[model samples]
Target: MLSLSDLRQRPLNVLCAGDVERHETTEWANSDDIDVRNRFADLLQRAFHA
Candidate 1:
């Protein structure tokens, strides 16, 4: 986990598992895609500053 102070101290870059075109769907939540799942996790991590 990363603290807010730590996040402010450095740049935070979130990378997708593949091409951007591959993840251009609005479906997330219960999607069965690994890339979508990983992207969702990334979103949560940033939102909670974890």
Candidate 2:
């Protein structure tokens, strides 16, 4: 199976993914197609900082 960890090690200029269903965001995620940019941003912030 393919994964971000595998791809992260290769030489690449860009990386992307979609469809994160966070259980905590139930109150604001009124639509399935909604773009949760802030949620991903927060995750990335924590990922890099930690």
Candidate 3:
């Protein structure tokens, strides 16, 4: 996610609830509901002016 954001040169807003080495996780990668994607989308949505 951060990689794609860096590629696009955008503001990265990350809301983390725990300490971690890296953000990458199998939880999102192997699930029907993507929590990481949803969180990233939340950041994107708030960044956009309505």
Best by lDDT: 1
Off by over 4 Å in 1: 1-26
- lDDT sort, best first: 1, 3, 2
Model 2 clashing residue pairs (backbone): none
Q: Would you list the C-alpha lDDT of every candidate in the order shown?
A: 0.50, 0.44, 0.47
Q: Given candidate 1, what's the lDDT at residue 40?
A: 73
Output candidate 1 Cα RMSD: 8.3
Residue 44 in model 1: shift from native, Å? Answer: 0.6
- Candidate 3 TM-score, true structure as reference: 0.33
Better model by lDDT: candidate 2 vs candidate 3: 3
Candidate 3 stretches with Cα past 4 Å from truth are 1-33
**Predicted candidate 3 versus true structure: per-residue lDDT over 1-50, tens digit per residue:** 33323332223334333432344445445556677768656655666744
Best by TM-score: 1
Writing each residue's lDDT as its tens digit, candidate 1 over 1-50 gives: 32223332325323333323323235664688888667776776897874
Better of 1 and 3 by TM-score: 1
The residue ranges of model 2 lying beyond 4 angstroms of the native Cα positions read: 1-35
Which pairs of residues clash in candidate 1, taking residues 3 or more apart in a chain or in different chains?
none
Residue 31 CA error for candidate 2 (Å)?
11
